[model samples]
Structures are given as structure tokens and as C-alpha cells.
Target chain A: MTIVEQPKASGTTGGAAPRGALDAAALRADFPILDQEVNGHRLVYLDSASTSQKPNVVIDAVSAYYREYNANVHRGIYTIGEKATAEYEGARARVARFINAPDSHEIVFTRNATEAINLVAYSWGRANIDRGDAIVLTEMEHHANLVPWQLLVQEKDGDLEFVPISDDGLLRLEVFEVLLHLKPKLVAFTHVSNTLGTINPVRQIADMAHAAGALVLVDGAQAVPHVPVDIEALGVDFYAFSGHKMLAPMGSGALWARRELLEAMPPFLAGGEMIREVHLRRSDWNDIPWKFEAGTPAVGDAIGLGVAADYLTALGMDAVRAHERELVAYALEALPRAVPDIAVYGPMDLDLRGGVIPFNLPDIHPHDVAQILDRYGIAVRAGHHCTMPLHERLDLAATARASFSVFSTNADIDALAAGLVEVERIFRG
Target chain B: MDDLYRDYILEHYRRPHNFGVLDDATTSHEGSNPLCGDRITMQLGIRDGKVAEVAFTGRGCAISQASASLLTDEVKGMSVEAAAAYRADELLDLLGIDISPARLKCAMLSLETLDAALADLDASASPAAVAAEEPA
Candidate 1:
């Protein structure tokens, strides 16, 4: 049975299936935050790009863990600990299945996608980057993806090169080809620009990187939450994403690497749970994922993530993709009409992008626009959005962004537009 | 629009203050808040230990621009010492709104730039007097 048939457990799961899949109205009902008013008006949440609101199922699943099976795993022989361990590992299996990885052993739980990317940089990058070598990346990466490689190049004596992006927001393939010819030791790029919402062609990029004799890491933070991902199908060497973006709690994410690649990579941090035996001198590391994990680990958070995955699974990825696409098209069509002075960033066409829309009004500051929207109970993100390098390329100091998700509706966009009208009036005055 | 951090801030934001070169200005400095992509360049026309005129121009969020306008209002006839000692917290308190920690820097970018401008003014004055005393 689809998870919807089960008792409504968490925020991420509840509205995924209407009678079977929950409609927008029903789904919004499950998110407690959506029921409130932001300013004097009804809340119109549009900042899913930063983080999504949880459904009742995702939240209850997290709370349920603390209430039920809250214990340290692996070390304790007690019942609760064993239950926690099973749930945690079960979450790993769920993640492996979600990405269609060959083995659950490849999934390493992390604090967020940032830490996941850092793990690869500190571990594999430290061992591999050599003098005169090059690390190819794109100009569209968030600081999380870019800075790690910059640090790697700094410490390891390699050059960090870039592949340019088009005005339409897609990566330039010809430029990528030229960068590939450099024979970089590794390639890293975001699967989607969290700010611009440009979805990169990961499968093709992965193939090109592999052909160039470079290991590929796709920052999947924006991609994972919007669509279903199959890592084997994409053929990427490493993929990283955050749980919070997918409606799970904060302080949770996973990095999926090929089993052989992870096995060869060194441990990220050396500490408790990750060690098999501890002598004062030298200690042998535990196998695959645990070796990389290093600490007590986020047990409940991991399980909550599993619940999020299950929530997405039951809803069906195609449906989520369709919903977001519809929302994007609606915003693209409607928001501009509402505020004629606005200039949107990223692809004008929805087909080349995810659901984020970053734009600016002619005279009003994005911060003012966002504050005005908040007064109308409409939420949006304003500023650099942790993608300073990309914005620098665009010559934009900052932009206000409105991102959509499954729970978003046409009405929310309408509220957003009405708020934008108010912003224009205020600015014009 | 009458809000303290509202229109006047947007006015300076849209058509920035002192937007061009100030060749005769005693000092000028630029400050950047990389996290939020806020940048400000403050120029001070100083005369005999007082800021005769202060102007700024840059791109950023409303808080940054509003803070810049507020800085101009706060520091324009004040001595370099007073402008240099302008506290980020006091400026934020003037906004009368709670802002996230991530945005605190945006509101202070212009103030920091003003501080740097004051130092540059002090430096420029020291060199001019030394040259004047040296028979040139």
C-alpha cells in the first residue's frame, strides 16, 4: 500500500496521495504553519528554495522517534537501542533505494549537503589532488560546492577551473568540453542552482567527466527535493543532498558515493562509532559508511529522513515534478503580469529549470519587497542566497526569490502577486 | 512608506547618494558583506576635524541602503571620532525591528565603510600637513 493509506504520520507524507494523493488543500491542512497568518493577511509561503514546510507525517515521524525509540544505536545491547539501530540502518536502505544505489553501504549520513561535500573534499580530495592537476567545476555552484574544491586546490597544488553558464541559465557544453580537455583530477557541480533553479544535465555531465578521467560529484541539494533521483542511472560518482529541503528536519542529509570509490577514500573524521577497535596508538576503521560517519550520528534525524523518502515515494516523483512544473509555469505566467517592472533570473522557459524564480523589481530593494510580501503574509527569500559567485557573474548584488513545492497553489501565487503590486506602489511612491 | 527603513532608503537605493567620483573628498572607502552580496562605498568631505559632507553609493538589500542613508544623517556634521565609534547595535536598534543574524551585516556595511572613510581622512590629513611644513 502507498504510505498514504497508513495513518498520516508525518508532514512530508500526509498529502502525498490524494484520496490516495492529498490535494493541495488537504496537504496544506497537514502543515500547521500554513494555517497561520503572517502579517494581517493569510500566509502565502513561497520560500521552498530555502527549506520546505513539513507535512504532519514528517513532523510526527520525528516526534514519534523521540517518544518511542530514542536511544544510541550499535553500542547498546538494549531493546530500544536495537530498535533505533534497525530504524537508522533501515533509513540508510531507504536512501540507497531512493537513489537506486547498488548497496546501502554507500550512503553516509551527514549534517547537510555542505558537510557531505566537505567530507569528499577532505577525504578523497586530500588524497588525490596533485601538482599541475586541474579540478573542473561550473560557475553555477553554491559556495558549498565551490569553496571545498578551492580549498582542495589550495592544499593540494591543483588548478580550479570553471565552465561558463549561458544567459538562459544552463551550463555551456562547449565550455565544459574545453575544461574537460584539461584532464582534471575531479569535477564537481550543482545538479541545480538553488538560487536560479537551473537544473543541470547531470547524466550527460557525469558521462563527460568520466570520459575526462575525473571523478564527478553532483551537489543534489536542489535536485533531490524536486524530483526523484536514480544515481546509477545518472552515473555520477558522488551525490549530496539535504533532508530539510525535502521536508525532513534540519541537521540531516546523506552523501551517496559508489561503493568502490567510498571504500578507497579515507575516513572523513576519526572518532567514536566509526572505529572498530581503539588502542591508544593505531585504530582500525570500521567498514564503508560507518567509517565516514565518525560520531554517535543523527539517529532520529536519519530515520526521519527515511520517512521523508517514503513520503516522496508514495506521492510518486512524476507527480511532484508535474506539480512543481505547473507551479513554475503559473508563477512565470502570473507574477510578471502582476509586477511588470520585475526582471527574472535564470531560464525564462520552465523546461530548463526547477521551481525557483529569482527576480528583482526595478526600483525597490529585494529586502523591502520581501518585507512587504511578509506584511501580506507571503514569504520569499531575498539576497545572495549563498551563491555569490553566480550572482557576481550576473552583476546582481541580490534578488528576491519565490520558490514553489507540492503544497503551493495558484492562490498562493495570487497572494504573492497582490503583495508585489503593493510593493510596486510603495516603491513608486 | 513612512517607515524608518522604508522609502527614503529606497530613494537612495534606486538613485544612490553621491554616486560618482569625489576627487576633492578628504577620504573614501568601500566595504562589502559577501554573505548577502551587499556593498557600500562611503565618501566623506572632511574639513578641520569635522565631516562637512558625507555621501555613499552602492547596491544591496533595503537594510543596507537604509543604513547608508541613516549613516549619512548620523555622521554628516560629526567629527571623524564619532563616526568611527558608531556601533552596529545602536544602528540596528534605530531600525526598531528584529532582523535575523544573517542580515545584521547588511545593515552595518555602510557604517563599516564610513568607519574606513574616517580613517582614510585621518591618513590624508597627516600627509598634507607634513608636505605643507616641508617648503613645498
Candidate 2:
């Protein structure tokens, strides 16, 4: 039975599926790549924060797209063409439904979340923001969120301000309120920190930004895969996320924006399929999303992403979130005990964070820790995790991050704990 | 078989050699690996066309710190010209460990810093200064 159709357990936080609700091993079985051995040991993948392993269904969906309905979208009137077009647009619609976007046309597929963020910063920022206007962001944002705004701020000669994170790694909302006093033209931030895994209160921040007459754009790349996100409920102007992080193919992501906002912004990329009437030099832009989606999209990847969404929906996001939370909770407690002097970053409160744990061992560089763990067939991401600014704020050069997905189990955490002991033995012994 | 953090490498990381600022440095340069945030400030006292003294101070991964420790030891008595021409492979040879491509930058940051220090010394001291001071 599909996980959503399974009897919903009514007890966890927000009625999140209990730890035992979703069978971890069964779900792990869904991902063919996770079953293999690495370095003569069972591959315990803790790098989902980087990119998730694809499930059989998602892999087959992409293969099936090229195998069967291989045609360009939106122009084919023939059977396979119509089928391809239907599938492509149907993927967009599925993304829209996944995020609870009011309209499917509001979702525009891009290469990845970085491209999605860049699309808004260029198309919307150029049109609306004037030179020297205040554009506020947080110190905790991934470089994707930071660099795009840096480019925009430079182009517009805009004043950029950052909302700093507190010692506990949560956003200083009061400080964000203080920055709103700048009456900023835009407030862009991440929904969850890629490094700290702190779940920013999107709705609260959106309310504050709206009160101060500013538009909010959230980098939902880390949020969409692990959390139950309803873009409507988040009440933000723009939401961006990647397909690769959520059991989908790489090369496919989406941008969800307010219909009116997308209607107003200029097209980001101009080419065929995004235009209505082409003259010698100029052409009328296509509709809300199509106008922005210039050239041919990654049709096969999009179909795979759509199936991935179905896979997640079938498993239910609440169960996914709950499953990861259980793993994180277990790791948070187990890691420090397993290896002394191990410092874990991000919130300790279960409700306040996602499954990411950026950490360090005394006198041990994250790179060394990761290298040692590799021998034990444990895959944890090390380094600044594309959040150099966040690392700077934390006074850390780099950190080893152990992030969890739905399929991660207590056994995986145990393996991580055991692997870390070996790192200590090699380095500290 | 490719055990990266061997005992000696870890020992170098734990108790790195000449890991302090040189107040008498003739030239100094700081090099960094932006990917891993490994920074090394290498200082050298150039005299009689030789590296009379060398020291480094920075924070980084074990690979980088240990590599710097080994590099400082290797270049302390080497001529300025030879130190400037210190190749990446030479440093890898001293490491005596197979550094995967990902950690190569970490392993090479030392040589990069030492080279930068020598370059800075060459630019500021001028070629004649080293030759003129060689007899003294």
C-alpha cells in the first residue's frame, strides 16, 4: 500500500507519523543504490543534504520517459508528442500540487534551485528594485541564496543588510525586525539552514516582512525535501527548491511565485517555446511560467521529478519528516557520547530543527573526519557545505555534516557513532 | 591500504613544527584553500640566499596543517630560489601518503604558501639585496 493510504497514526507532533509507522528498511529497499556495499562495508549514506539517492521508481520513471514518450513538449500534436507534452506539463502540475501552489502555472522548471533563485533575483529584482534600495538577507543562507542577491545588489547599487543568527543558531527574528525598519524592498532568506539545519519560522518572518511593505523570497531547497511545506501556508512571495535533493533527478528544479508577481516580472531567458509571436527582432512573451522557461526543458528529468513527488506523497511528508527527526534526535544524543569533545551545531530542540548536524571534533579537521569515515563506508559531507558565510558566523573554518533522509535509521546512526570512534582512534590514540 | 591519517601525519597535525609567527621574517604570505577554509601564513627569514628561518601559523584540516609542518621542515635550510621553485610533487613525496584529488589542495597549501612567501621576498628585497647581503 502507498504510505499515505496506510492507516495514519494520529500521535506525533502535528500528527507526524510515529517512528515505527514507516518501515525504514522497506523504504531503503526502494532505493537500489543504498543496498550496495562500499569499501567492504554496508554503505551508510549520511550525505542526503548534498543529494539524495534515487529510488527505483524515480530511476525507472526517467528511463521510461526516454524509452517510450520521447518528444518535445507543447508543440507536438501527434500521439507521442501529446503524451510527452501532457507528461511534462503534468509534472509541473504535480509540483504545484506538492507545494500547494494556488496555480500550476506559477511553477517554472529550471536547471536547479540556484537557477530558480537567480531567476527571481534577476527578473523581479531588476524590474521592481531601484538603485540603493535595501535588500535584506540572513547570514545563514547558502551561497545560492547569498551570491544571487550579491549580484543583484551590485547591479542595482542596492544596500544589502544581513540578519544575523544567534548563538543557538536560530535566526534573531527580533534583529530581522530591526532590519525591517530599513523598509527594505525585499527580504530573502532560506527556509532551513543548510549548515545549521535551523528551521526558520517562514510564516512569522513573512508576516513581519509583509507588515514592513517588503516582498519575501525563501530558498526552500533544504526545506521541501525534509519538511511538509505548503507554499500557501508559508505565505511568501517566492519559494525555490531543487528536485535532486528530494529523490528526483539533478538538472530539474522549480520556482513557485505569486501569480501576480510572475505576471509582472520580465522573462528571464528569451527563446522559442516561451514566446507567442516572433517578429524580426522582438516577440511577445508567453504566459506566467512559460515566459520564464525559455528553450526546451529537461523533460525526462521533470517526469522523474514528478514521479519522485508521487513517491514522497505516497510515503507522506509527515512520515518523512518524523522519520528524519527520529534519526536526528538519536544522532544528536548518541554522537557526543560516542566520541567525546564532539561539538554539534544547530538546535537541539526537536521542533526547532531539521535532520542536519554540522559538527566538529577537537583538533580534528572535518576533512580528516570525513576521510576516516569513508573507510568505514559512512558518507558524511565535510567542509563549509556551501555556507562559508555561515561558517564564518559560527567561528568555524569548516564542519562535518551528518544529515538524514526518510530512509535513514537508528542503525545508520549507530554506524556513524561507531565510525566516529575509529576517527578518534586513528587521530587521538 | 590508502590510510590517509597515518600516525606520523596525525602527529604532525597535532604537534606541527615551526607553527608560530616569525617576528624576524624577511617575507611572509598567507595562502588559503577556499573550499575547505584552510589558511596558512608562511613566513621566511631570507639570508645569504637561503631560507635561514621558516615558520607558519594558521588553522586548517589535519592534512593541510600536517603538510605545512612537513613543508616547513623541508624548506628551512633550502635556498630562496629553490624554495620558490618547490614543486607540488616534492611536497607530496614528503607526505609519503596518497592524497586523493579532493584533498590535494589541502596537501599542497603549504608549498603554495611557501612559494608565495618567496615570491613576496623576491619582489620586496630585489635580486641585488640578496647577493649584496650574501657575504655578511
Candidate 3:
């Protein structure tokens, strides 16, 4: 392994806080991976939209569950099994409380947010939607939220309509209101766009969709990590988010739907754990949430996710939001002045966006920009970001996206700005 | 300058050769790098089992466009059989840069599209070749 020498003036720590609210330097220490150097410079991770770096608490929680109580949940009668079952179920309860679900039984654990959306698309979507019915979506949805419904609508001979986004990257609410007249059965959208960081008006959209008699599903994969999300308060029928994006281990996420909706929908996956009794001819399902989770679930990761929720709750989501907003505001102001030809996408107003900043430097492809940034030990994502339709609409093949998390500091954004200068020097010089 | 984005790669990317559609091309194939949305379409005019003319048109990153630019130049006079037998490593070696595994597809996209166009030629040449090309 290559040992990277820490730069003397790396600015790994020591930044003035906006309101003395979030001590990002101290919080960065909690994540062991952030302490290291990359390519002779301090590792500046700006890919939280892909997956977040885990803190020691979440890591320890997962390891403790496996080390102390390693057994299958909801099955064995032994002491270890019972302990495992308690931890697994306890994680479900934590998820319920984290999202403000009406009942713990409404929270169903899946592999990730994608699987959770797929569960609703296949189970609830198949049962309710039929021929000539319409399902509404927005242009900014990640493929996870869009593709499943597309497949369902195609199979059921249903119409899949999309509400367009403006050039400023905000969804056209008036177009959505017009689409609601189609009497669609569902209206699904992302709470926060993974690429543009545009935060949709979830509550208002949900109310409009509800008035139109359409069920709402909010893809909160990007929202729950950076902002305070209350599913019940949003009044959405189904909400999905991933644990890995929230400082927990992968293979853990939750789908919080209405209890009546989950109870009425058929099981997405059928297996031993989800079935109460199985015979050669037929079988009976377990319950609302259990019916959705089949086979051996990711128990340890769920426990780790529970610990992650506790960590976020301790820090408080409002503080996380405030910290990121400060960083993003600094970035939005700094990037344009630092690189004159830089073209940034999404709303200029901070209230209309989140921590993700996707932009393009003049005369440089996003891939080359990313490669050059990698040399400066600044990691950023460069691709279509699984929202190809949005890219097409924006008339861009790809853009360099730098996303922030709780551990992100203004210093990291400074590194990103300096790194783009290097990109300009290398590409245009 | 970075080793991957060498002067030659940048020159080829900025002023690509044979980077327009052939109106009278005999065969054409298009492919896209789904990860980055880099697309390339290769057109070939074959005569007497050799590539009489070749052209390409698409939008992509430096690596992919340069690779396509370099590939059309290399295969202009080569036989269809030689182009079909072209290896991915050979193309990477021609580029003369260390490519990460993630961007290997970008560097090899032109070759894949060229191979597909050659396959299309083979399918059009004989009925037996069409049967052979079909997956079992």
C-alpha cells in the first residue's frame, strides 16, 4: 500500500463556523477514512450522493451485532437468535421513528431504496393500476424511481406521463397540475435530485396528487441524508431512502408506506421468513412489513443503520442542513468567481437546492475534469448520474458533480475550486 | 499535462479524422457507453473483403472520441477479417496510455462498434453466417 504524505498546508481542519453550530473538523475525526491522504493530498470526498463514509459508531454497531449476537432473525429459539431478532426488529422501529411513520409495522427493510421502490411498483402498482390508467413522474427522477413504473405501466398498458423541468432545474408545478387532470393512479418523484440537488416541494405536490386521487411515492434517497424528512408530515403514501447514503452500511434501507396500503398489497418477494406456513399447493404471508421482506434479511446492516439514525438524531437534521447550506452557498459563490467559464446547473437560490453542485468547465469534458481533480485528491462524480433524460433535456452529456455531507467543510470546497483551476491549466493551457 | 490526456489525444479529440457520416457506406453500427452516455456510430464501405472507406460520427469524452478517431485511421485499409480479429489490448496499446478499468470501455467503444459493423457485413455476405451469428 502507498502511504501518502500529509501536506503541511492541506487545511484538513481549522475553519470558522458560520454560527458555531456544526464543528465539521471534530465530526470529520469520527470518520476514520477521512483522516487518510490520497495522491499526496488530504482525501476530499465529495461523492456522498453515491454513498456516504461511515462513522466509527455505525461501524462498531454492525460489528457488535455480528460479534455478539450472530444469528438469524425471527427464526431460531435460542438466546443468540432472540437477541438478533430483537436488534433487527429494533432497527425497524428506529426507521419508523426516524421517518415519523404512523406504525413500526409500516417500515419494511429492503436491500436499498431501489429495491424498496421496486417493491411498491410491483406489488402496489400491479394491483391498483390497470389498462388506460396513467402514472405521473417528473423529468428529474433517478432511474430507480422512473424505470420500475415504466415497466409496470408498459405491462399494465398504462400511460406514463412526465412533468417537465425548467432550464433552471426546478420541476414545472403548473405542468404537474395539468398532468393531474389525466387522473393518474400514482405520482412519484424524488425529494432531492441526486445530480442537480433541486429539492422538490414534497408536501404541496403530495397534497395536489392526493386531491387528484393519486398515491404519492417520494424517493428520499438523497433527501433523508441531508435534510429533515417526515413521511407522515409530507403526507406521501410511500417514501423510500437508503441507509448507505446516510452514513450506514450498504444493503440496508427502508420503505415507509401507509399501513393499510402495505397490508392490502401482495408480498413482493416470497420465501421462508415472509411466509407463516408453506405447503405444496399454497402458503400464507406473515404480516405487513415481513411480507415484503423475504429470505434472510440484512440484519447487521439494519442495526448499523439504526445506529446511524441515532447519530444523525444526536447531531440533529437541522444542523446538518444548516452546515451543508453554508458549504453550498460558499461553493455557489466561489466556483463562478474562481473559474470564470464554469457553467453550473440548478437553482441559484440556496433554498431551491441542496448540497449537490453539478457543473461544467469550458473546453473540458467532465471525464477529463474528474481525472484532473483526482490528481488533486478531490473526488467528484462525472457521468449522466442515471438521469439520462434530464441530461438530454439540459443539452449536456455529463457534468462534474460534487456533493456534500455532514463531514464536508468549506476547506473541501476550497480544494475543489483549486482543483478546477488545475483542470483549466491542464486542459486549456 | 496528465499522461492520459497527452497532446496527441487532445489533438485527435479536438480535430478528429474521418468524423462524419458516409452517405454511401455499405454497413453501419452504433453503440453507446451507458455509464457516461458516450455514443459512437461507425460506418464502413467494404469492397473485395477490405475496408475501402470508413467514417464515424458521435459525441463523447476525449478518450472515446480520440479512440474512434484513431481507430478509423487504422482500419481504413485493413481487411474485414483483421478488423474483426482486433483485440482490445491492441487498441489500448495504440493509444499508448494507462487506462483505468472503469474507462476501458470508453477507449474500446470504437473497436466494439467497428466489430459490430464487421459482423453486420458478415451477416449480409452469407445466409450460413447469419445462422452462426444468432445466439444459441
Per-residue alpha-carbon lDDT of candidate 1 for residues A219-307, written as tens digits (9 for 90 to 100): 99998878768787789999999999988788899999988989999899989988898999999989989999887888888987887
Global Cα RMSD, each model:
4.1, 3.8, 6.1
lDDT per residue for candidate 1 within B1-136, as digits (tens), equals: 2253455566655665455556777788889877666778888887877888877777777778777876687777887777788888888776655667656777778777887877766665687766866864
Overall lDDT per candidate, in order of appearance: 0.81, 0.87, 0.88
lDDT for each residue of candidate 3 in A287-397, tens digit (9 for 90 to 100):
878998899999999998877876776666777888899999999989988898999999888988999999998757798889889887899999999898999899998
Which residue runs of candidate 1 sit more than 4 Å off their true CA positions?
Answer: A1-22, B1-20, B77-107, B123-136
Q: Ten residues in a row with the worst lDDT in model 1 chain A?
A: A5-14
Model 3 TM-score, all chains together:
0.92
TM-score of 2: 0.95
Best lDDT among the predictions, by candidate number = 3
lDDT of 2 by residue, A388-416 (tens): 98888889999999988878899999999
* TM-score against truth, every candidate: 0.91, 0.95, 0.92
Regions of model 3 farther than 4 Å from truth: A1-20, B47-49, B125-136
Q: Chain B vs. true chain B: TM-score for each candidate?
A: 0.76, 0.89, 0.91
By the lDDT metric, which is better: model 2 or model 3? 3
Residue A214's lDDT within candidate 2 is 98
**Model 3 chain A: ten consecutive residues of lowest lDDT:** A5-14
Better of 2 and 3 by DockQ: 2
User: How many backbone clashes can be found in candidate 3?
Assistant: 0
